[model samples]
Target: MSEFKQLYKPLLDGANWQQPDQLGIEGTEIGHWLLEQDSLSRRFQRHCEAFTVSLIEQVKISHAALTNDERALIGDEDCLLRKVVLQGDGQPWVFARTLIPISTLTGQERDLEQLGEMPLGFRVFTDRSGRRDALVVADVGTDTQPLWARRSRLWINEKPLLVAELFLAQAPIYGKEKQC
Candidate 1:
């Protein structure tokens, strides 16, 4: 259990996820910010004239096993866990992480492993299986104020990949000035 905990430490899986339309968010502007339509990567591009995807970490951990939810979507496969920050006009905005199985990277998505600093959604939206669905949205933070986040599965040829996007605490949508 401790090993599982440590492996998923970088993720914010502490709270339960809610559906946007079903969730009764009255006074929370943050909730609305996270419920934006279309792919987040595309939204960032449209909103910000100069958007960037900055890779933070990409590693292979043999000791780490997938969570039950992840395993269901990704299957019993070795994955490349990659994390990145979405910056808008040089301002830190959203933090995104993806768990991509090695098998998925070798097929139609052969180019995915080489995305480097490019947005993950670029490859995600290319093929017919790029549509994102079965989303889980939540708000997480150790402090009193929590940031909004969403997760979903991206499928290609029936193979699944998990993608999570978190609206950072310092993100402009919360309180700061315009990002673009």
Candidate 2:
């Protein structure tokens, strides 16, 4: 177990990223990172003027069973899955996977049909009517030691879309690890 997992897994994995003000959770290193309000693109740009979003994989995949909160908003349906790494000065900082349900695609939201290398935050943050839902934060992987991750639900034109963004363990804040 990582020093952090021993220190915060009970606090992080079980956390409802929405209520960040909860006791015993404040003043955490990872907590501050996840609490940033700036668009991810802008944040990366600040880190390096030559920041880039490298497309890792994007595909339309069969939807898997979702959690209760997710199913309540966007019904279970095949979704467009986009995975990308946000790089700062050629170094990867974040691994982001955005899942846009086919059922939620309607009207202008359909513009996501071809995202290419654009940051999903660009599409969601720019919408005047769009609103970000409470983030669901966790660090869930095979190791289960805990890493930083945040899930956001953006409502554009009343259409709900789910996006999950993970802060790579090597992302400099928690202490950089080998890039590979």
Candidate 3:
């Protein structure tokens, strides 16, 4: 396992994922956020005066060490794992984790490894070659304080990157409801 995985085992281990529609959240506001096809960072900025991406850690993990779900999506290749928290008005709103295969970092794409304090969603949206796959939702927090998350495969220059973003309790995407 990567250091990030070891450090965040509770969040990443044994996660349960389901289609948003199957979970009956497709018509809700949080559902809208979960199913957004555009840049989540842009949508977040529209709801908050200030938005920031705070890096937690970035590490490289061997394919043999990745979680089963991660391995299934990213295939059997060594990858770079990046963890960050997206904040709105100084309050943490989302925890994002990205997996980029080492082979994907070629030419201009190597810039992805050096995006300190920059949101991955912004980069994906700005890049014309970026394409988003279908999303899956999960409850990663707890019963009392559910942290809803969305995960998807992003293709940039025909390379695959996995992105998972868990909505924090203070996220405005939760709106007036406590659960999606």
Best by lDDT: 3
Q: Name the better of 2 and 3 by TM-score.
A: 3
Q: Please identify model 1 stretches exceeding 4 Å from their true place.
A: 1-11, 25-33, 142-144, 175-180
Worst 10 residues of 3 by lDDT: 1-10
Q: What is the TM-score of each candidate against the true structure?
A: 0.79, 0.73, 0.89
Ranking by lDDT: 3, 1, 2
User: What is candidate 1's lDDT per residue for 52-160, written digit by digit as tens?
Assistant: 9878788764415777877876777789888788888787677777898888777567777788898877777766666767777876665687677788887766767
Winner by TM-score: 3
> Is 1 or 2 the stronger prediction by TM-score?
1
In candidate 1 the C-alpha lDDT for residue 144 amounts to 83
Q: In angstroms, how far off is 31's CA in candidate 1? A: 5.0
List model 2 lDDT by residue over 22-113, tens digit each.
52345776666666654767655655657778776777877674556666656688788777777777776777767788866778998876
lDDT for predicted candidate 3 compared with the true structure: 0.82
Across 76-175, the per-residue lDDT of candidate 3 in tens digits comes to: 8999989888898898887778899998888778999999899988888899998888679988877887778888999888888999887878888767
The candidate, 2 or 3, that scores higher on lDDT is: 3
